[model samples]
Target chain A: MLIVGGGVVGASIAYGLAEEGAKIGILDAEDSDFSASRGNFGMISISNKGFNNLAYFRLSYASSRLWPEFASTLREQTGIDPAFDLKGKVYISVGDREFAAHAEKVAEYARRVGAEYQHDILNRADLRQMLGNVRLGERVTGGSFSPLDGIAEPLKLYSGLLNAIQRHGGSILRDHRVGRIQHQRGIFTVEGPWGSLSAPRLVIAAGLGTPDLASQVGISVKVRPQRGQMMVTERVEQSFPYPVSGLLRQNPEGTIMIGVSTEEVGYDDRTTVSVLRSLAMKAIERLPDLGSVQITRCWAALRPRTEDGYPVYQESHERPGAFVITCHSGITLAALHKRLLPQWILGGRKDALLEPFGLGRLQSASAA
Target chain B: MRPPHDLPEPPHQVSFRFGDEEIEAWEGETVATALLASGVMITGVRAMSGRSRGPYCLIGVCHECLVEIDGLANQRACITTVRQNMKVCRQTRLRPLTGEDETREQ
Candidate 1:
């Protein structure tokens, strides 16, 4: 088995397969590339993950459920704790009306998909007690919480998966950028500067590199770069018990994380003062006390976004056993890649339902 | 959390630094303490444009304390903790571009 791109998604998948008694080889990338795993906010995001797509919601929920066990398993195996926190994810709202509308959306989607939804409402006073040092705004209403949603440090998770998979007999070829993937007859070949790999089954999890690899065959993907900028604060003790929705997560370290503005910046992962200031001030309005807290880091990373900003799981029509899996929420889906995806990779039953998530959706959506 | 602003104490860890100094912090410790403890509040960068910046918003929400670490420039110093002897440098202070491009000859 061959896996391209050794970030959290690929590493987790490779680790899962290797642990499950499958031979796995990973071709990692060079340092300069935009690794969502390195700069990801690490939210096991489930709140409005697939607001328009129900399949995404289901896939995200499954990954969320498998998070704790998967995190612990990797921790136990590699002694690298990804800091799985599930106090809950809260989505602050503009007003009660907005809250109700979002709640209605989730509730309606839950009923439609037969998935249970959980949430609560809180006023200013209620909110203050919840955020230890946070100062709440008067207009700020409460948010929705999902037991199945949480966060982890994406970098830690990526590194852990890399180590654990390697420990479990998976080979990782870091700093090797894959240039081409050619398939002939029943064999799939992956070529790069360092070397080339030939296998019956080939898996491409390279964030933005998937299209180039897929196009080598007859498959094409609509995957595009969606850059997100995030600001990290100096560690403040327990900034928030649980992560807040809208891409704000308080890491285990004492610091409030503000971030993750999604933009179509064409792979330019550079931060700007206007956007950074806006994000900081917006977060401060809700938690005014953070005004004095010192911000420590601000950076941007390109999200491997499909046109609709969701995951794409595809098997090439021209090349059998050739698959491409890409998503902006690599951290959130890390668990699924570990626990479930190995089956699909091993020539096991393919879940046809995932077909809706393929790049073909981008074409149809564009046409519509 | 309906407002997301409300939340009890959650646990976490991270490092903070000011210039060459650094400190260990908890999930609840703001970057201010981390910087003050290490005594790194001065800056060579004079904020060529906006107001002078420093550690303000230990909660990663503010850009006041942004610094450059590793080769990646413009990192929020207050939001990130001092991890693995991270090589941190101050943001570019307007010292007039001195690179090869500045000496443009026909």
Candidate 2:
């Protein structure tokens, strides 16, 4: 198996396949590639996902459930803790209107998914109890809390996955920006700046580079670069009990990750003052204590999102052995990509879980 | 004309003004090094949060050593050369002072 892109998604898939005794070779792009895996919000969150698509919600929920075991396995195998914390995730609402909307959304999602979905629409008092010492601003009315949603240190997770892959006899070729991919007679030939390699099966997990590589294999992957700008504060005393999605959350290291503005700026991953200021202001508004924290660094990353903002996991019909997997929620979906995706890729079993995420949905939506 | 190691040691004693307080410094050293040597930490305070920050990564990588030098804002102290009678102050923010603000300061 040959996997293009040695990011978290590709690394996860490669590690899983290698564990299954498949001869795996991963070709990673240069450091210049727009790597969402390195710059994600690192939330294994299922709080505000799958608003329209139930399959996405289910996938995220399942992945969040699997993360603890997956994190432990990686730690046991590679002695690197991914820092997977599933304590809970809180989504704060600033005003009464926002709180009502959040409550409604939580109610609707619970009604739709029923027993599978679990969350609590906390009022101001409940939120105060849950948050403990962490003070919420005066404007914060209420929030929604989900026990399943959590976070992991993404860089550590990626490193552990890579280490596991290498330990399991998988070869990783770094600085290999795959330029051309050719498929003929069930054999896939991938050409990069460094060299070419032939494999019976090929997986394109190249993030923003997915569209181009997928097209070579006749797969119409409608993935575009959606840039998200984020800011990091200097290390402070840890306050928040769990990760908060909407405004800000302190990592275990005491540094808070404040994010994020979604801009369809087309591969322009440069932080702007306006977006960063707004993020800082909003963070301060949510947590008044953060007003005394210094922003150490700010960065922007291009997330590979499909047209409808769902993942695109599709096997090329034109070329049977080629698969393209792309998503914005790479961190949230790492467990799924690691454990289940390899089965679908190697066994050729089109699991129903992956049904809603295929290219057919895009075609149908476009046709309609 | 000589190698850096063979070069004569510059004056060991130098003085600079850190805010209103006059502090002793070493010649031919960066402002950050001089400040650390003088036990003067918290080089600057952030604009947004008003949080105090000190020099991190003494090599000029992290921008944590931002300070005001000779009435100029947003100077990187880690890279800036310290000279005799150089006036240094903790930078409150990244925003540059306007003409009116500069005049008021003067």
Summarize candidate 2's per-residue lDDT along A1-368 as a digit string, tens digits. 89998988899889889988899999997888888876788888786788788888998888888898899999999999999988888888999999998899899988888787889888888888887876789999999789878878988998999999999999999898889998788899999778899999999999888888988888876778888899887555566787777556677645789986898889788999999999988887777766666577899988888888898888887888898898888888888888888889999876678788888877632221
Best by TM-score: 2
Q: Write down the lDDT of every candidate, Cα atoms only.
A: 0.71, 0.82
DockQ of each: 0.02, 0.07
- Candidate 1, backbone clash total: 57
Measured with C-alpha atoms, the lDDT of residue A274 in candidate 2 is 95
Error at A226, model 2, angstroms: 0.6
A122, model 1: CA deviation in Å? 2.5
lDDT (tens digit, per residue) of candidate 1 on A18-40 = 99888889998888998777667
**Per-residue lDDT tens digits of candidate 2, residues B2-71?**
1145457555667899988888766677888888877889999876578898999877677788888877
